[model samples]
Target: MKKVTWKIQYDSTPLIHRHCKKCGKKTRFKSSDQFRINAQRQYLDIWLIYKCTKCNTTWNATIFSRISPQALTSEQLNQFQENDQALAKNYAFDFDLLRKNGAEYELPAFSIVGDDIGTGESAEVKLISEYILPIKVSTLLRKKLHLSQKSFRELVENGRIKDASGQNLLKSKLNGETTIIFLP
Candidate 1:
């Protein structure tokens, strides 16, 4: 087995530069890739994050560190900002549901709690609290967001996915071209 060697090439800043064997160019350590990093640990969550500035060839590196606020330097602060943006994309805001006939339902015949609602379409959607709508309506969220039959079913089978909101993937109504009449 070949012996491993590491050189501490950091200058005045908390940064280091390394010369890559694949591309004989010097690469600087990105600040984001430097936090919570354990150079010796190669876990799946541990990003092997060595990169060449010139060639942009990203590999991995391990460093020892713990999760703490002080560990969150200016560099890590930037990474946090990037992480927050990614977390926000998974959900959408509430949309009011109205029937296709321009009429609305004032009361649900009965309340549905902890039960499967409508199918892929035709489900009623409402804002939180008093803004609730009894209208047989849906957010039309399905068309905008879809799992592409294969992936959707796969997710269901894996059990890693579940619909706790009791939504049906089958029921349907409304098309993409439905005209929108804003409530006054």
Candidate 2:
């Protein structure tokens, strides 16, 4: 985690206007800091926090909300339960698929993976997640660890590669499996 510091002006809630004493200018604020409520704070985030663009003023702000961290309305709780149930079912199905399939998987292209999937390109990447060496990183290990890719797969399937780092990475990849993709 990094340190973060914020410099802001103390202004009224729903900060609307600011008066520049020097210029005798009053202009409407373009946007509200409330929009940044979703941001995560770092340890010393000095400049990352909001600052006034017009007068370079700093402001403190506040908002009111009744919901506690654990306070989920019945409707929200039900929706969350339903979502969790659906996720569990889907995860079970995928787990079974992965169990039968071995490492290497395919998923739609989006975000970090947007460059990888969702096209006429075939989705059949290699399944390396469940196998000892994570499929996505297997090729790299093949060179660095001086391990044969074929032999590595055979070793992993046979319960051989038992190092702590290897095991953890394999586990994480299986949990957050990336779609197997072909470079060519």
Candidate 3:
């Protein structure tokens, strides 16, 4: 099999150093994925729980407010009921949910690994999100590929490589595969 792709996996752990209302300072919250479920008639209320790193104060990121039990799939219910970290990681990166609760969030730290699949002049870098989202990749490429800012800018200006969206790949949000081509 010819290996023609490089895979980059992002870290899903949140970097949302939010301000704890109780602690009165900015603190990082850790997601427990352990939900507090309450049964109300035919509705199920769910909340993804978190804790303040500094003061240990708990905060609830509501997932469902009296949602019908049938609304969630069997797998989703299992994931929530069993405190699945992967599911929680997805929720932790939910910008809408985070903003709805008036919580400040920062981008998570990412670790990028390039998998060499083929020896060729052209290479495809597949960016996979651990949190099921798109993330900016210019900084990542600079750090991983060791390209200076000026050099990166030149590449974008010269149209050497396009991003996932098929445009100049400067600071583009990467969620899928991108092709990097070497020019003669």
Best by TM-score: 3
lDDT of 2 by residue, 3-105 (tens): 1111111122122344545446664332222211222342111111123447655432222123342454666444433444332223322433333423123
* Model 1 deviation from the true structure expressed as Cα RMSD, one decimal place: 23.1
lDDT of 3: 0.69
Candidate 3 weakest lDDT stretch, 10 residues:
116-125
Look at candidate 1 and tell me the lDDT of residue 1: 15
Task: Give the Cα lDDT of each candidate.
Answer: 0.32, 0.33, 0.69
List model 1 lDDT by residue over 69-107, tens digit each.
455576554553454322111110011311321222222
Off by more than 4 A, model 2: 1-70, 79-172, 181-184
- Return the lDDT, model 2, position 113: 17
Candidate 1 vs. true structure, TM-score: 0.20
Supply the TM-score for candidate 3: 0.80
- Which runs in model 1 stand beyond 4 Å of their true positions? 1-13, 31-45, 63-184
- The better-scoring model by lDDT among 1 and 2 is 2
Which portions of model 3 miss their true places by more than 4 Å?
1-4, 10-12, 116-120, 132-134
Residue 86: error of model 1 in Å? Answer: 13
Report the C-alpha lDDT of model 3 over 38-98, residue by residue, as the tens digit. 8999999999888887777888888899899899999888888888877787788787788
Comparing candidate 1 with candidate 3, which one achieves the higher lDDT?
Answer: 3
Model 2 score (lDDT): 0.33
